[model samples]
Target: MHLPGYPFESRWFTHDALRLHYLDEGDGAPVLMLHGNPSWSYLWRRLVLALRGEHRCIAPDHLGMGLSDKPAAGRHPFTLAARVDDLDALTGHLITERAAPENGWTLVMHDWGGPIGMAWAARHPGRVSRLVVLNTAAFPDPHGPRVRPALRLPLWLLRETRLGERLFLRHHAFARLATLPPFGLRDRLPPDVRAAFLAPDDGREHRLAVQRFVHDIPLGPGDPSWPLLVRAGETVAAFADRPVLIGWGLRDPVFDPLMLREWRRRLPHAQVHAFPGAGHYVLEDAHDSLVPAITAFLRR
Candidate 1:
């Protein structure tokens, strides 16, 4: 992906027959940046560039996202548990390649990434040195981490009404809306920046991850990903003692103050910074402040 300010080499981690895309830049302490749905490793491009000089920045685009191979519905599990497993397998391969730094890894997560990264950390608790959370959630908040009312019906329609393929696959509604104003971002996207975000999601099949990510949100115990989500919640709750930093965008419609409060309840000792004007794309809107804060946090 040759874009402005993201001059990094592409690396691949093989899983079965598919090629998972990742970025390995610079050296020293390893920082694994995991992105959520509708976004890719491209979401962490700024953070990677900022810290690549002093840190080994490894950012992977999850299967069906970014440059990774997007297998058809039945071929890929497309569940939360599978996403976590994919991340673990990719990192394990990296470890074998001597890509891991001497120090334990640092995890930076956003959106769906909170669950994936934390689940991996749960698998190897001692290996994660620190955690830096953006606007994201590890567990479902049963009571009130409520998505905005305006978005509730449309999301329900997308999930239950079988309307996902039409909107996501055909019109690219979710993908297009994510980078623009009042949808996922607080700032207006420049043409090039918006284009970069939309590049991987070109054809109908390419939008599967975006569609499945929404459909996979486990609402109850009967859901396919419920067991793993429970474990992720339990594991994430136990990390209060680990050094943690949170930079939240107060304007996020889905992950609002309630989500932040939930995170605080789980990790009471975490250092948190809330950006009132920033939206779901906190990394993009609050980059100036968040990037430096993350840089300093990692150094410490």
Candidate 2:
């Protein structure tokens, strides 16, 4: 498929035997864009084109999400922690080569990307300069409706059942995002792009990450990511003292206005723009307005 406006690039970090796929373009300060579940670096296509001219935009396809390699369960554990580690490794590699300064890079997060990217930022508080959040969450459960009820099933069955995998991927929420009115790209993405999103799972035997991602929801005690999320919450609170911009789509079924309200409560000083007409894919729905707002925010 032709990913016009958004090209592709690759980077390898030997420390973790990790081959990271990212978009490295433009110049000046660095802006790292991280996407949420079911989507890949492709999510940031418009954002990349908008920001690259003024900043070095780096958007990576999380290990199993986009164009990155998808190792089997025994070979790789696709947990939230593992995802954070990958981000750390990639950033460390980039810094060593002086691709970006350790303290000036901005973070752009969406969906599950909030936790993964914020976890890394919490670990290295000094490295993150600004935060641009888009309908994502970083703190503990906000008492909102969980998006994936099907994920609550048994890990073995959820991962192993071909039917289950297909169902989850083709769920209404995501499927709608990919084929919605304004920004649906079902027709635009080639078979490979679509396959890249689903091919990581070869039945239950290789879907450890997807299973773990579902199981790791830090709703309460005993959650594996609770501690990290707590620390991330604190980091977000502290980071709020810096510049923060939130662009939201109110019509989103998941991460709706409630999520935006939560962010507003936490960061009262943040610049927020809410789109009541748009859906979960705020970038796509409001690309024309969002890109300019983001650019202006960065320039300020």
Lowest summed lDDT over 10 consecutive residues: which window, candidate 1? 141-150
Q: Give me the candidate number with maximum TM-score.
A: 1
Model 1 stretches astray by more than 4 angstroms: 101-103, 142-151
Clashing pairs in 1: none
How much is the lDDT of residue 31 in candidate 2?
96
Candidate 2 Cα deviation (angstroms), residue 32: 0.9
Candidate 1 lDDT over 227-257, as tens digits, reads 7877888998667888999999999988889
Q: For residues 1-300, could you state the per-residue lDDT of candidate 2 as single tens digits?
A: 354445656554443564666778788899999987667777787888788788998888777555566565566667678889988988887888855777888899988789998899988988888889997889875763353563345434544586556544444233334444434321244455444444444444434444446546676556677788777777788787889999998866557676788899988999998887777678867888988999999999
The root-mean-square deviation over C-alpha atoms between each candidate and the true structure, in angstroms, is: 1.7, 4.3
**TM-score per model over all chains:** 0.95, 0.82
